[model samples]
Target: MHRKALLTLLKEHHPVTADEKAMTQATIEFVEANPACFERTLLIGHITASALIVSPDRQQVVLIHHRKLDRWLQPGGHADGDPDSRAVAFREAEEETGLTSLKLVSPAILDVDIHPIPARGDVPEHLHYDIRFLFEADPTEPFKLNEEVKDVQWVALNTITTRTNSVSVLRMVQKIN
Candidate 1:
């Protein structure tokens, strides 16, 4: 059921950039070929969900300082067997940022990304086929940090590059602009 929904979402999604267009196609193909794509055990790569959370006013974005990656990034994590990417994105955003008032900007996917995760412990290097959603929340909300992240901050949308140079991040920023 999840696989079918994801395939439908991918089919309806219209990517905003040439790079994202390619990634979306690749993600669709990957999902079609891998029934276990929602599981992290799919060592080659797996589906992940992310939230690009913007302030209610749209001037700032919520970013987290990831402990493992050691970079300021949007709140996200593995699907962990869940196929509802929108729900996953919302859950991760709340878990990572401790913000309770988050509202989905749309039911449609905000972005799609495929990036490599370095080998760690028992896990080998693999790609993260990320499906992202847009959310809006109060930047003034109190935060509770989980062990997975070092810190969380509300960053100006225009200054995102100062935090991380991730092409995917920049692309999402551009999409909202």
Candidate 2:
């Protein structure tokens, strides 16, 4: 049931924004069309999972200064061979930020994004059909930095609004608010 939660969200919720509507439809279509989409070996495009981790009080979000992208973004990565998107999100969050106490806000997807990733090493440019899930992490917990990101910090919600400008990121924020 890789798509059960996501299909439920798209079918039940009337998205407020055009971006949300489009992304939801796209995700449904993509999943319905390709059963092997969970594999990163699918060069055409693959499912990338991301975790939008917010503080328990909902005032701040944890973002990583992605070493590759050179920008502040949520903690996430490719699904590899995993068919479970939620598991992918949690694993990536822990691996990227070392937050063992992180908890998922919900099993349902918070957002879906389709973005192009530039070629890295021998990998060709491809689309990342990112399925994002909301999560909560302790603001007081000491974060252990990893090689995946240059820096990690808790950012105020307003700062995310002003800086990230990503539709999916903002939508995740809206989900909590």
Candidate 3:
């Protein structure tokens, strides 16, 4: 989406708080002032969401072993112009994991995690502002892994912390417990 269009949408949907407005404005100005920055980035500067999908038993969490990153990550992706981050998180989670019976919790789990994208082939580094949500699903929900993922599993939360998962994923587990 164009930077101006995104800003206008944000203004209309985002909480009309001073800080939020200022941040939105600043982001717009940055993009406008530095087109090169936008070109270099993989994902445009906009809101995005992800989900930490937990089982009904709450003992395990759905995770994807990302082939590109080679680490366990929650199912999520860009908002794709969706103003509602929670809906974005849910959509991506369902699409990537193929779990349709998931339920999003009210007072949606929220967090901001920024990470640098590794240099891939000729693409340079970029960053993602991951807004995460917590969701619940039946313990036996069927899963069909997408090609974007190397593997998917319902891993015990404790096991995730022991492995080399991203700090954001680890922090998510900590927050839930």
Candidate 4:
């Protein structure tokens, strides 16, 4: 969507303070004006989020091995006009993983990472600003993998860094302590 139109939609749906609104608007403008800038620029430019579904004892986390990317990642996607990015994160996690009984904690903003989309054979390059958020789920809840993921498993925290996850995902795990 165009920057101005997005800004207008955001304002109409999820009103924020003048300063916050301006900042969000500016980011939308910058992203629309220079799509390439997304690859390098980090921060709040693109407000996306991920759900870090930590185990009850905080010893492990749920992760999805994305089919297309072939890398493990926390479940999440674009906010898509949702005012609460945390909600977006949780929703995506549930939808993608088929675990509906998860619960978010006190809404901790874990960390943010910007990375380029892998070069699909025919797709243009894009970028994602992954705003990670911490959440918790009952350890016994049954999980069903969805097609968006090639595999889904709960991995120990120590094993996370050893996997083929992005460096950003590792960094998010580091912040858990």
Winning candidate number (TM-score): 1
RMSD of each: 0.8, 2.1, 5.6, 7.6
Model 2 weakest lDDT span, ten residues long: 5-14
On residues 1-177, what C-alpha lDDT tens digit does candidate 3 reach at each position? 445543454345442345434544555555456534323343434455789988877788888887778877898887655556677788889888989888986543344555667667866565665567789888687788888888888889778765545766776776566
Q: Write the per-residue lDDT of candidate 1 for residues 112-133, one digit (tens) a residue.
A: 9999999999999999999999
Question: Model 4, 39-112: lDDT tens per residue?
Answer: 33333245566898888788988888888777788898766655466678888899877887788875545655
Ranking by TM-score: 1, 2, 3, 4
Q: What is the lDDT of candidate 4?
A: 0.67
Residue runs of model 3 more than 4 Å from their true location after superposition: 1-46
TM-score of each: 0.97, 0.88, 0.72, 0.71
Error of 2 at 55 (Å): 0.9
* Model 2 residue 47 lDDT score: 82
Query: C-alpha displacement of 25 in model 4, angstroms?
Result: 14
Which digits, one per residue and each the tens of the lDDT, describe model 2 over residues 62-92?
A: 9888999887889999988787778999999
The lowest-lDDT stretch of 10 consecutive residues in candidate 3 is 35-44
**Residue pairs clashing, model 3:** none
Model 2: colliding residue pairs:
none
